[model samples]
Target: MGILDDAFLKSLWVFHLATGSCNNCDIEILDCLTPRHDIERFGMLLTGSIKHADVLLVTGAVNRQCIPRIKRLYEQMPQPRLVVAIGECALSRGVFIHSYNCPLPLDHVIPVDVYIPGCPPRPEAIIAGLVKLIDQRKAQTGQAKV
Candidate 1:
C-alpha cells in the first residue's frame, strides 16, 4: 500500500455536521468519543475541519437553510471521502419529515456511503457503521483480507 493509503487506514479523521437536529443524535456522537466507547482506539478521530476529514458523519435532516452549507461542506472534503448518515432524521427526516423547512434527506444533498437508522442511534451502532465503512474502504482499495 502507498503512504496515503496506509495513513488512511491507520487514522480516519471525521467531521461531524449537524444540519438541523434535535441534539439526540449529536449527543450519541459525543458518547462515541467518550472513554466508555472510545472510538479513538480504532483511530477514528473527530476533526474540526472538513479538509482533514476522511469521513463525514452527518446528523439531522437537511433543512432549506442548511442545504447549501451542507453541500459546501461536502464539496470541501478531500477525495476518497465517505459520508455516514446518522439517525432517522438524516435518513428520512424522522418526525420532521412533514416540516416544510426540511426539504430533503441527506442523500439528496450529497452522496451517502452508510446509514445508521434510529431516532437517535446508539453509540455502538454508530461505531458499527464506521467499521462497515472502513471495511468497504479496504475492499475498494484492494486491501481486503481473503
Candidate 2:
C-alpha cells in the first residue's frame, strides 16, 4: 500500500466541535488524550482545521445559532469522513433537549456514523469508539485493519 493508503488505515485526524454544553464532555474528550487513554497508540490526532480532519468528533447538543457553523465545518472536511457524536448532549441533547435554544438532533445536521453515549463518557469509551471507526473504515476500504 502507498503512504496515503497507510495513513488512512492507521491515522484518523479529528476535528472537535462544540455547539453548547456545560464543558464536561469537552473535558472528557481532552482526557482521552492523556496518559491513561493515550489515543495516539491507535494513531488518532486532534486537528485544528476541519480541512485536515478525517473524522468529526462533536460534543454538545445542536444549538440554533451554531447549526450553520457546524454544518459548514462538516462540509469543509474531505470525502469518506466519519462523524462520532460523543456524550449524551451530542447524542440526544442530554439535559438540553428541551432547551429553547436547542435546534435538532445531530443527524438532522450531519450524518453521524457512531455515537458514544454518556453524560460524559469515560476515556476508554471514547478511544473504543475511535477504534471501532477505524475498523469500520478499514472494512469498507478492504484495507488491513490496524
What do the candidate models score in CA lDDT, each in turn?
0.90, 0.84
Candidate 1 residue pairs in backbone clash: none
TM-score of model 2 vs. true structure? 0.92
The sequence of per-residue lDDT tens digits that candidate 1 reaches over residues 16-112 is: 9998999999999999999999999999899989999999989998899999999888899998788999999999998998998998999988999
- The superposed Cα distance between candidate 1 and the true structure at residue 20, in angstroms, equals 0.3
Best-fitting candidate, measured by TM-score? 1
Query: Which residue pairs does candidate 2 place in steric collision?
Result: none
Once fitted onto the true fold, the runs of candidate 2 whose alpha carbons sit more than 4 angstroms away are 1-6
Report the alpha-carbon TM-score of model 1 versus the true structure.
0.94
How do the predictions measure up, each by TM-score? 0.94, 0.92
The local lDDT score (0 to 100) that residue 64 gets in candidate 2 is: 91
